[model samples]
Target chain A: MSAAPAPRYLARPLAAIGRPVLAGLASVGRMAIFTLTVISHLIRPPFYPREFAHAIMTIGWYSLPVVGLTALFTGGALALQIYDGSSRFSAEAAVPSIVAIGMARELGPVLGGLMVAARVASSIAAEIGTMKVTEQIDALVTLSTNPIKYLAVPRVLAATLTVPVLVAVGDSIGIMGGWLVGVNRLDFNSAAYLKNTIDFLEAADVASGIAKGAVFGFIIAMMGCFYGMSSGRGAQGVGKATKLAVVASSVLILGSNYLLTEVFFSG
Target chain B: MIELQDVHKAFGDKRVLCGVTLTVPKGESMVIIGGSGTGKSVTLKCILGLVTPDAGTITVGGQPVTKGDRDAFLARFGMLFQGAALFDSLTVWQNVAFRLLRGAQKRARAEAREIAIEKLRRVGLKAETADLYPAELSGGMQKRVGLARAIAADPEIIFFDEPTTGLDPIMAGVINDLIREIVVEMGATAITITHDMTSVRAIADDVAMLHDGVIQWTGTVAEMDGCGDPYVEQFINGRADGPIEAVR
Candidate 1:
């Protein structure tokens, strides 16, 4: 009897797990269809140029200060860490080249992209998710305005354009931070550190990082729009969607950072 | 001006609306009354194309409401949702002038704000209220702002979905009276869905009782007292026992 009950309990748990797995698959299928529908709507007419312009200003220009501050500080800290670590092996001479390459190829774009994903993704999801909960999305449809074009396209475009620029600026500042640390902290000459950084960093490293930034930007905005549009009814639903957007964007950024680095750096 | 013919809607295994049919003539105020979950709100949503009926036809101003053309069809109608449904990010003036600032009716910001403030005043709100957000307003004031927005474009048809649901008796009466005045002034066809008898008596020219997703009886306010239908009687009198089941 005891053995029978144990097996029955195990069966129930197995069934419970199976149900959610199926449900999750179904949800993914529904989301795919919704995404396709949104894309189709995006290419159609009745475009709202004014709304697009406003979104670009809000998502891109307004977000610059936060992204800039994050990138600058991260670069400065990275330089300090690299200098300390390299001095252990009596390889202090390699500090300038390693810092320059590391910042341009990985740290600069990844940190900048992650910071933006936090700021931009959360804001987009929260704003649009609230609109969805309140039936304003329905109201927009009733008013003959296409919600995808008015809401999604502008955000996606702004992130795509702005993140690359953010990455580029971040790369320059990060290299400058490394240069400062190599000279001031590691007792390296300022002129030699600057020359070494300039010599070691190649155009491909910068280009690849910026390219990753653009892709990261697209992923961040897409996740935000997707979650916001699919938010369920009421305040709790909006809050959940906002949290999911931030988490999803952050995960995708880190994962993509690895993949992009592999692609760019593999021998 | 709005007519539904044998409308039917079901969610999964549960049937909410089962062949509901009703009509509201032009320049008239019709109030639909029903207990909760009997499809009173669903009927209004069907008419507005907010909810698509599984089977049946809904027409407005003699034109059929096709699925994709809901926007153009809805443009002629104004709606006050159950909870006001104001945009939280927008100021009171912006919410009121939303439609006016879109499409062909687009106005300059200053002009839109001026019109919005005027409408706010018409709803008995102060000019300073226009700069505030909907969150800052009282429930009654939010409903008033919703009313202002609904009538802002002077739509030929207006829908009030439980306009008095969350208000006190006095506030509900005020809203009912305001609705009556606005409908009369605009000469527009208005459909209001409510369970509030006070709202029914105050605003309805004709009253329709929806029981079990069908119109049990429809008549003028004078005729409602003499309706004689047991279901209608049970509802209007708020009796505990009647022919209608208390449980599903």
Candidate 2:
């Protein structure tokens, strides 16, 4: 027997729900295609060495201070929280191990990635969006230059290579922050805290964080370029693209962090 | 010759171009005149292959614009955008010499700079203006720089999209005269899209009136005034009441 149709009142709610779902899925498909295009361009020839060098400096060297500061503060706060919790069970001595593991496996890469996304993604989107609006991108095309090769590839490659180094440095700074809190506030011996952190942190934990960082970097650059290139006209269009790039990159960073953690530790 | 045969394009529900057919013979200056949002620019872009048409075809020198080597085809043409659209980061000379600094037209740095300076001088910009960025220059200077950049490679075809839009009367006159002189001197085929009647008279060898996504009239500048076509007469005379609607 044939099924009866839904009631008239249900149609409005169902249509409202289905509309956004369809838009969201379509957006995801577009982003996937954009990512593949970027990958295809990455392996092609006619590389721009000068543009590449400039991107490395912009993405890597310039992002160092903010990443380091975020890691330091997060580590210090983690140490304090761990000490307070552990002391309830007379396990205050466990602060060093817990802080070390937390900073190395989670806080360092996630916080550092978020900071870079805030700084880099917004700027890339604004710059490229403005270019698109002003027709400089079309100008580049009329000059017989490929916009993807000239603009997207170098920036994406630079971000992918640099964020891991940022994460590694952030991990070290975070550990140092935890050490300082452990020694001065918790009344733990410096030598004992250092030994505990060193012993408890596994190589795989730090490696996994760095790997997460690389993925985050790729996401940041891709979101920036995709939104920028597809931005609408005028100042409002540029502003919207910039906002979307940062928001999307940040959410993706957090979501991917969870998935990466699950993959690395689920077994 | 460049030819567009029944080219059509649409964005969502709004149809921009519907069966636009026209031609510019070799080494002739063809100015397309139409009201705002009438697809004058789209027709130019279709010929340049910047915007793809949903139907019909465009060709340059009897070869389809969509086929063969894109770079080789583009190398034959240069364009001055309505906003000048200079690269904000590059200095005047660098912006002018951008095409020369890379790709197949790559030249020695000194040579490219020399050519850039010469083009700047040709556009009536002084040597001192070369080092200044686009933001540092006045609107007229920026337009001149854009014109210089378009001619830097000595392209065989050149396009001017609203070349005098933002300039004062004197500056507008200067730009119109410069475009005419350069097109003649270089023997370049020219396709300009402008509604500026003064510019039309100054630069056009032949004029085509585009309205409602089709050519309403076509003739030489001398014939434009007495063409007797309602759309062309209404547009050239700037009458608020006519066959064309005032409000888009």
Candidate 3:
């Protein structure tokens, strides 16, 4: 083939590389437009209160048990690990303070968000994706209802408002978990451990974690809806959207968690 | 009255509608026929504003279809989707009264339910059927519920998309007859997109054949038989060897 000519050969590889990059950029642009549409509809008239209430009950109330379980186990494990590590330098007494700070500042919001993403995001994506495939979304439009307002905004608003509350509950339950482990397993003085946890955790520490939760909740519900509206083809398309909803929401929660931490404590 | 002038649309590289133009005068039922994927449904969607046209204007009642008061605009029109797109989450009555439950068409909950029951009765559904979800109904029952919802608000304009695509011949004939009676009784402007000649003869005052993204023929149903347009002739006769491919 005469080596395929040097310039043409280089052009083929370059075009191949540019193709995926272009597609990715286009995907991002589409998502940005969808996000803006959702936000605009959020403030407009004809808001659906029934739908919003239903979403709050689904995303917030139904999600509490799993969140509680995850917080409890994580808190206990965290206390044990902190006690073991801090003992090397005769610093075992620091377990209560560290566990309180850790649960309140990071683990509470991040883990609760990821758990909700795993549970709720996938469900929202699957439900909406199936609706798209079955043409119910189109039916809603033809019936003089805006799908963004009826479907997306309600779920997103519910998540944003409820997740911070969930994070607060998770934080309390988590601290209790640490207290139980510290008193029963770690042999720490009971009153002293409680006093240290309470003293080390400032108002800002709890506020910062709950605030992170609100951001994570927004990302979780938005990704579910974003992928759902953008779903394609058929059963396989819905399946892919469900998977991406969970994966994207989890990654976004962790990434935004780090960014929010930097902002809240960088000083 | 409704009119489309030089409407154009495309999905990526596939140009689904290229310069489609047509008009339906007040109280007339216009049927658009074309082979699969030749943009028949896209034409209906363009009029409904579900799919935006890349070019040209659509007007309803001598006003541009895209402008002001969308709720008021859509409230004047009703559409029966090809797949009977009822909300599975709701019972039959809820789906029928969906429009009445909110917006400018809002009604008291009890009144809306009563109207839903009345519409269901008109479509031959029993009041007891109103409490059943769409999934619990047979396909024909579901289609009737969809039809009930379409006419629940007593729209000034009604569009039926593939009204008999997936029904047995007897059920299809029943649906076609009901559609004919309903359209005549209401005197509503109707546009139906379907390739079924039986439905055409049963529903159309005027017929338009779409081919290759444009109107291939336009005339009354009486003229469709003698217009000598090969595309219309081939399509109506279901010929495999002529213009519309047996396999596009």
Pick the DockQ winner.
2
Question: Taking the tens digit of each residue's C-alpha lDDT, what string does model 1 give over A69-114?
Answer: 7666766687778768877887777778887788778887888888
Docking quality tier of model 2: high
Instruction: Pick the lDDT winner.
Output: 2
| lDDT of model 1, residue A67 | 70
Please write out the lDDT profile of model 3 over residues A186-239, one tens digit for every residue: 888899999999888899999999999999989989999999988886999999
Per-prediction DockQ, in order?
0.48, 0.85, 0.74
- Best of the two (2, 3) by TM-score: 2
Clashes of 1: 0
- Distance from true location, Cα of A171 in model 2, Å: 1.4
C-alpha lDDT (0 to 100) for residue A95 of candidate 2: 91
What DockQ would candidate 1 receive versus the native complex?
Answer: 0.48
Model 3 stretches with alpha carbons more than 4 Å out = A1-6, A188-192
Q: Model 2, A7: alpha-carbon shift in Å?
A: 8.0
What ordering of candidates by lDDT runs from best to worst?
Answer: 2, 3, 1
Tell me the deviation in Å of residue A168 in model 3: 1.3
**Residue B204 in candidate 1, Cα distance off native in Å:** 1.2
